[model samples]
Target: MSNMHASKLFDVKDKVVLVTGGGRGIGEMIAEGYVSNGAKVYIASRDIKACEATAARLNKQGPGKCYAMAADLSKYEDIVKLIDELSKKEQALNVLVNNSGANWGAPLDEYPDAAFSKVMNLNVNKVFTVTQKALPLLRNAQKKDGVARVINIGSVNGVDPPALETYAYSASKAALHHLSRVLASRLGPEGITVNTLACGPFQSKMMAATLEKFEESIVGGLPLGRIGTPEDVSGVCLFLSSRAGAYTTGATIPVDGGSLVKAKL
Candidate 1:
């Protein structure tokens, strides 16, 4: 009963968090949740303008502050630079959200050779690399009673065959989900936790084209009868980062409104 209250249990106040690809889309939503709840959030992306703009906007709604940085994390050098920059600003990192990703769609017969490598590199390889580079900071945030968090934003496509033919995207996310399990097992003993959220359809730029073309069909097929909202993603994020979720590691919780369950029509 000492910390049973929701405020104390789910509090992320003053936690140093770094969210990559946070300039827009799902990243922006998650960042806003932390900043508004008093977590010192740092958002990064390759687009300097978007990063700067997002930071500026979120800072205005703060009990916590948001910082912006630009880095193309697909490259090893840039990953190193990003971590170095964050290290200079913060001695420790309480949460690291590996949210930036990419996708490519094409018929299997016409898929380009470079699509697999490029998409996989950004969606899977770079996440591992960024987490590796950020280990020291994560370690510093670790403690006997609490742990550092690594939240990888994944897709339900990884959990099931997607409605679209985003082959490489599905493959990469599946790989990411497994990778999170491996990392979680390896790091849990050291006061760190790694988890992935197998998201369903959210209103993201990444999903914009598909939604525009098939909104009705997609909504109709979902068991919950709707797509995801910003609150849906943010609420899950806060839970995972808070004390309430400290015991969860290597989990791939779905944020999809039971879309993977399919409608029983």
Candidate 2:
């Protein structure tokens, strides 16, 4: 590919995108990346005000636009309502980024059954249901030559379990990664691509407490010698959503700056 062609390969301009849990943290980073690049983005979360605030903040920056929607994705009806509202405005969706998730931390014996259930329900189960309900829009966006992208945000902890005792959190991410692979097999024939982004620690709401305490240790531990920034995950997402990554599917691509590599060393 020529320079122009190569540049165009990573282009996501004007594409329609929906990012769940896009209120803050990694999801917000990803959303801003797309919006800045001229992709119309819809960010949905249980926190309507937060989503709206993010949408407003991004919209101010502009060539691409962003809209906000409220959906407690943990519930089936709310998922349907969100899709219904989106369906009212747009007929197609080019990129669907499932970033909404939950985490539960507890010791092995102290882990509550209810907490486990809640974590599993929000982190694993809801992702499936949201993807299921959005199939029509995803299909609408698919092309014979180009496939729609479904990037599932997962954790590096899923691949290499950390010392932390967030049993359900790790397990849920692992399930999500496998789920992406399985869905890839089924959705491939239908002109949609599925993949998991096995991400390392990023400065996000989820990792605030851990990072606050162990920022130095975590930085020292990583081969990259730094934690992830927005560009780290956003760049990978652009690659996967654009023409460049059309052929790549059913794969777990890491944005961990070689954390997994450091783990074995």
Candidate 3:
């Protein structure tokens, strides 16, 4: 193909993308990026006001286009409703971004079982359930490329320990990574791609709260000598969902800026 056509490798024109937890932070950035690239973006979260506000602001910002839908991913009923509602609005579901998650940190000895369950419910169980519920929509929308795209938001902690106490969070992310690989294998013939975006620290609500408890030494520990940003996280998702990443599936692309390679002397 010509270079002009090649530039269209990452094109998402008219595609429909659903981004959970897209009301703010990393999810919001990904939603904006997709909208800029010509996709009809949908922002989903528990906070209806925040979702609507983000949609309005994004609509104000050329080619700005998106909608906001409120649905608690942690709830099965809500997931069904979301899938049903979106199915009615769009003919094909091109992308699904599982970004809604929660975390809690405490010394292992003091970690509460309730906290662990809560985090896992949202971080892991919800991811699996939402994807399962959305699978039909994805299947119905697969192109000749033989599938739709599913992006699971993972964490650097899923690969290595960072002295953090997010026990359930890390484990859940690890499971998500593994699950993505499994889905890729089983769903390949069905024409869908599944991948994980293992991300590094950024200006997220979870990171902001953790930063308050940590120190600058944390950033110093990263090989890149700086923390990651929302762009860093969203860029990988964009690539994976685009034609540029069509051949790639069952891969965990780490957007950690090489933080996982760091070592203590």
Top-TM-score candidate index: 1
> Whole-model Cα lDDT per candidate?
0.93, 0.91, 0.84
Candidate 1 collision pairs: none
Q: Model 2 TM-score?
A: 0.96
Instruction: Give the lDDT of residue 84 in candidate 2.
Output: 94
- Estimate candidate 2's alpha-carbon lDDT, on a 0 to 1 scale: 0.91
- lDDT of each residue in 170-224, candidate 3, tens digit only: 9988988999999999988888999999988777777887777664777777888
Best by lDDT: 1
Instruction: Indicate the worst ten consecutive residues by lDDT in candidate 1.
Output: 138-147
Query: Quick one: RMSD of model 3?
Result: 1.7
Q: Residue 91 deviation, candidate 2, in Å? A: 0.4
Tell me the TM-score of each prediction against the true structure: 0.97, 0.96, 0.94
What are the per-residue Cα lDDT tens digits for candidate 1 across 153-263? 999999898868899999999999999999999999998999999998888889899999999998887889898888999999999999999999999999989877773
Residue 226's lDDT within candidate 1 is 93
For residue 150, model 2's alpha carbon misses the true position, in angstroms, by 0.4
